[model samples]
Structures are given as structure tokens and as C-alpha cells.
Target: MNWEQALGSKAELINTALDLLLPRASAYPSPIHEAMRYSTLAGGKRLRGAFVIAVADILGTDGERVLPAAAALEMIHTYSLIHDDLPAMDDDDYRRGKPTCHKVYGEAVAILAGDALLTLAFCTLSRLQEKGFEPGVVLRVIQEVGKAAGSQGLIGGQAVDLDSEGVKVSKETLEYIHNHKTGALFSASVRCGALLSGAGDEELQALSEYAKGFGLAFQITDDLLDLTGDQELLGKKPGSDLAKNKATFPGILGIGEAIKLAEDQVKKCQLSIARFGPRADFLRGAANYLLTRKR
Candidate 1:
């Protein structure tokens, strides 16, 4: 299958796994459970989760070996989105074309929902060993996910973002935010997939570089979309970064420069994965897709 079709297939698997894993809507403390599903199952591209499947494919790994990690990453991503839209964060009312979690479930439930999703992510990762994976591999995967989503990774990036907001953020500061906020999770996804497949050190290192380049390209285009994309196509308001006083690639470098940077990054990623030949074709295609995606 093409990368898009493979991504869609993996997304379906992730969504199904998420539904089965999460507490039912009728569970005690029903509101939070419902809100968790509402935010998570609602729908998105599932890029991070899809990476697990894609990387596994590249390494000829079994789906059973990597699906758990993929699903866990999606849960973590959803949790981040729920919290990132809260009053204390972006203060937005919309995500993926629906009301924000806080808007629909109220602040208290939204916060709790985010917390629940984050917890569930770790719980999901812990199940890998139960599926007969080597305990050591499972442990490493768990640690990787924890670090990726914790203070030193996504959360830390968010902290830098909040601090840099409304200030004259330097290029280095912007790079820090991009690497930590976006690159960390992307890199983690690749690592999890590679490790699950037992890829050698050289292959892992190459994929690591590919993931970083892809991540930088993704973020740069995200910033550019905020400036040039249609709100409807983007599933949110355009120019929001400017309105929020958040620094972006286009904000630091001109739009032309930003586009050049993104394209260059994509090229670097392609080069990094070139040794894998057709095995990484999907990854190369996926990286390029980021440049033209409307949402």
C-alpha cells in the first residue's frame, strides 16, 4: 500500500485499540471517560501512531510487535492536544473541527480527561510485556515514551513555548521549541518502531536522523500553514500564532526562507533513509506529504 493508505489502515487499528482499552463511557466517573473518548476517538491523522506501523513495515517487523506502542503514542498525543487547548494553554475553542474538550466538557473535566489519557498511554505501553515481548525491550520502550512525553520532551518544549510567547524569541529559542515540542515525539515514534523490530545500531542511527529531519520539516510547514492556509482546511483559525504572539518559523525567517528550510529538511531526511532503498519509500513520501498537507 501507499503511505497514505498504510497510514489510514494503521490509524484504524490505533483507533480500535484505543476504544477497547479506554474505560467505557458508562464507567463510574462517566463524564471524564466520555470526554476522553470524545477528544481521542473524535479523529485526526494519527501521524505519531502511524510512524510505529511504518517503521515496523520498513524493518519487516510483525504488526503484533509494534501495535501496542503505536496505540500508546496516539493516546499520549491526544492527551497533549486536550491540555494544549485548555484555558491555561492555547485557550482555543476548536480542534479537529469540533469544540475543544474544555468547551464541551468544561475545564475541570477537560483537565481530568487529559490526565486520564496520559495515564492510559503508559498503561497501554506496560501491556507490551504481557503480549510476550521481551521484558527488557518493553521496559526500554516504556522509558522512552515516558521521557518523550515528560518534562524533558514534549512538556518541556511546551514550557519553553509558553515562556517565549510574547517575547522576542531568538532563532535558537525557536529551534529549541520546535525540536522539543514536535521533534521529540516524532523521534520517539521512530525509535520505538525501530527498536521493536530489533533494527541494528547503524539502521537506528540513520532512522534517527531521518526522523529529526522529517520533524523539523513538519513543524516548519505547520508554522507556514498558520500563515497561509485556509481556516476550514486547517481545521482551526489561520494566523493564530500571530494572534497568540507565539513565535514561528515564518515569524523568524521570511515565508520564502521558511519554505526553503522545510524543503531542505525533507531532502536531508530522504538522504538519511536512502540506504534503506525501497524499504523506506513510504517514509520519504510521508515526509514530503507534510509540505503539501492542508491540515
Candidate 2:
């Protein structure tokens, strides 16, 4: 499949897995469950899940073998988004063209919903052992995902980002926020997929480089979107960073420089995967797409 088609197919699979794994909306204490389903099941690119699936495909790994971890990645990403949109965080009203979880469920329940998702992500990974993945491999997946979502990774980046708001930060600090807050989980997703497929040291190294470059490009583009994206297409108000006085690449570097930085990162990502040839075309296309995406 082409990149777009592959993305859609992977997203469908992820949604199906998420629905099967999560509690029904009608279950006891349904409000939280409903909120979880509302935000997660809402349409998205499912970019993190798709990234995992795509990496697995390059090695001909069974899709089912990676599905559990891929689902976990999606859950983690959704959880982060839900929390990030809370009043204590970015305070967003909408996401993916729909009301955000907190907006529909109230802050208390939304917070609980995000907490549930974060807890569920690890549970989701534990299921990999049931699918015949070795205990050692499953443990590694847990470690990778946990580290990416925890203090040393996503949360740490978010803390730095919070502190950087309304202040002039160095380019290095801005990159740190982008890398940890956004890039860490992305790198984890790619690494998890590669690990599940039993990739060699060489392939893993290349993918690691690719992941780093792609993740940075992803954040840079996201920051740019806050300045240049259409609100309708973005599914939320633009200038959110400006409104919050969040430190962003464009705030630290000019728009032109930020755009150029993303372009450079995309080029490096594509090159890192070049050895995979046509098998890596979708990834190359995906990296390029992130560099130039409008939303």
C-alpha cells in the first residue's frame, strides 16, 4: 500500500484493537470509560500507531505480533493529548475536530480518563507475552514504552516546556522540549516495533537515527502549524502557543529557519532509511509529509 493507504489501514486496525481492549462506554462508572472512548476513538492520523506498524512491515513481521504494542502506543499518545488539553496544561477546547475529553467530561473525569489510559498502556503491552512474544522481548517493550512516557522522556520534556513558557529559552532548550515532549514517544514507537521484529543492531541503529530526525521534524512542523495552519483544518485554534506564550522553534528561530530545520531533519530521516529501499518508501514519504504538513 501507498503511504496514505497504509496509514488508513493501520489506523483502522488500531481503532479495532483499542475498542476490543478498552471497557465499554456503558460499563459501571461509564463516564470515564466514555471519555476515554470519545477522545481515542475520535478520528486521528494515529500517527504513532501507524509508525509502529510501518516499521514492523519493513521486516515482514506479523501485524498481529505488533498490534498489542501498537495499540499501547496509541493509548499513550491519546492519554498525553487528553492531559495536555486540560486547564492545568495547554487548556485546549478541541482536538481532532471534536470537543476535547475534559470539555465533555469535566476536568476531574478527564484527568481520571487520562490516568486510566496511561495505566492501560502498560497493561496493553503485557498482552504481548500472550501472543507468543518472549518474556524478555515483552519486558523490553514495557521498559521502552514506560521510559518514553515517564519522567525521563515525555513528562520531563513537558515540564521543561511548561517552565519555558513566556520566557526566552535557548535553541538547545527549545529542541529539548520538542525532543522530549513529542519526540521521545515517537522514538519509542519505532524502537518497539523494531525490537518486536528482532531487528539487528545495524537496522536498529539506522531506525534510531531515523526516529530522532523524524521526531524533531514532527515537533518543528507542529510549532509551525500554530503560526501558519488553518484553524478549520487543524481541528483546534491556531496560535495556541502564542496565546500561552509557549516557547517554540519559531519563537526561538524565525519561521524560515524553523521550516528549513524541519526540511533538513526530513532529509536525514529519509537517508537513514534509504538502505531499506522500496520497503522503506512509506516511511520516507511519511517523514517528508511531516516536514510539509499543514495540520
Candidate 3:
């Protein structure tokens, strides 16, 4: 299958796994469950989950062998999105072309929903052992994902980003924020797949490098899109970064320069995976797709 087709197939598989993993919307404590499904089952690129599956594919592992990890990553990503849209955070009204969890389920339930998804992610990760993976490998995957989503990674970047609003930040600070906020999980996703597939140190290192460049390019393009993209295509309101005076690549480097930098990162991403040749085509396509993605 081609890259786009492969991604679509993987996303479908992830959606099915996520649906089965989450509590039913009609179950007890229905509101929270509903909110959890509301945000997660909503459509997304599912790129992080796809990365996990794709890396496993390259290593000759069946995607099903690592399906739990992929699903967990998506749940964690959705949980982050729910919290990011809260009034105390980005305060977004819409995501994935629908009203945000807080807007639909009330702020209290939305918070609980995010919390539920986060904990569920860890619970899901534990299932890898049931799939016959080694205990140590499962533990390592859990640790990697937990650290990426914790105060040292995603949360740290978010905290710094919140603090940097309306303040001029150096390019170094901007890189740190992007690397942690977005790149950390990207790294974890790739690493989890590699670990699950029993990849060698050399393979893992190369994929890690690819993920780093991919994450940075993704964030830069995201920033640029907020400034220049159509609102209808974006699903969420455009110009949110500008509204908050958030430090972004476009804000710091100018639009032309930001675009150039993103292209550079994409090149790095492709080069990092060049050793894998044809097997890395999916990953290379994904990196290039970042530059032109409408949402």
C-alpha cells in the first residue's frame, strides 16, 4: 500500500482498538466516559499511533503485536488535547471540527475525562505483556511513555510555553519548548515500536533521530498554519497563537524563514532514515506530508 493508504488503514485499526479499550459512554459515570469518547473518537491524523505501527512494520513485526502501545499513545495524545483546550490552558472552543470536551460536557467533567484517559493509557500499556512481550520490554515502554508525558517532557514544554506568552524568547528557548512539548512523545512513539519489535541499538538511534526532525518540522508547520491557514480547513480557529502572543517559529523567524526551517527539518528527517531505504518510505512520506498538511 502507498503511504496515505497505509496511514488510513492504521488509523482505522487504532480507532477500533481505542473504542474497545475505553469505557462505554453509557456506563456508570456516563458523563466522563462520554467526554472521553467525545474527544478521542473524534477524527485526527493519528500520526503518532501510525508511527508506532510503521516502525514495527519495518522491523518485521506484525502491527497487532504492538497495537496496545499505539492505542495508548493515541489516548495520551487525546488526553493532552482535552486539557490543552481547557480555560486555564489554550482555551480553544473547537478541536477536530467539534466543540471541545469542556464545552460539551462542562469543565469539571472534561477535567475528569482527561484524567481518565491519561490513567487508561498506562493501563493499556500494561496489556503488552499479555501479548507475550518480555516483562522488561513492557516496563521500558511504559517508562518511556510516562516520562514523555510527564513534567520533564510534554508538561515542561507546556509550562514554558505558557510562561513565554507575550515575551520575546530566544530561538534556543523555542527549540526546547517544541522539542519537549511535541518531540518527546514523537520520540517515545518511535522508541516504543522499536522496543516492541526488538530493534537493535543502531536502528533505534536512527529512528530516534528521524523522530526528532519530524517533530520539529511538524510543530513549525503547525505554527505557520495557524498564521496562514484557512479556518475551515484547520478545524480549530486559526490565529490562536497570535491571539495569545505565543512564541512560535513564524513569530520568531518570520514566515519565509519558518518555512525554510521546516523544509530543512524535513530533509534531516528523511536523511536520518536513509539507511533503511525502501522500508522507510512510509516515514519519509509522513515527514514530507507535514509541510503540506491542511490540519
| Total clashes for model 2 | 0
lDDT of 2 at 93: 97
lDDT (Cα, tens digit) per residue for candidate 1, span 1-295: 3778877887898888888988999999899999999999988998898888888888988765677898899888898999999989989888988999999999999999999989888888989887777989989989988998999999999999999889998888998898889998999999999988888999999999998898888999999988888888777888878999998989889899999999999999999999999988778888889888888
Give the worst 10-residue stretch by lDDT in candidate 2: 1-10
For candidate 1, the 10 contiguous residues with the lowest summed lDDT are: 1-10
Return the top candidate by TM-score. 3
Give per-residue CA lDDT, model 2, range 8-106, as digits (tens): 888899999999999999998999899989988988888888888889989888877789999998999999999999989999999999999988989
lDDT of each: 0.89, 0.91, 0.94
Per-structure clash totals for the candidates = 0, 0, 0
Mind giving the per-residue lDDT tens digits that candidate 3 earns over 179-280? 999998999999999999999999999999999999999999999999988888889999999999999999999999999999999999998899998988
TM-score of structure candidate 1: 0.98
| lDDT top scorer | 3
Judging by TM-score, tell me the better candidate of 1 and 2: 2
The residue-level lDDT of candidate 1 at 8 comes to 83
Model 3 root-mean-square deviation: 0.7
TM-score of each: 0.98, 0.98, 0.99
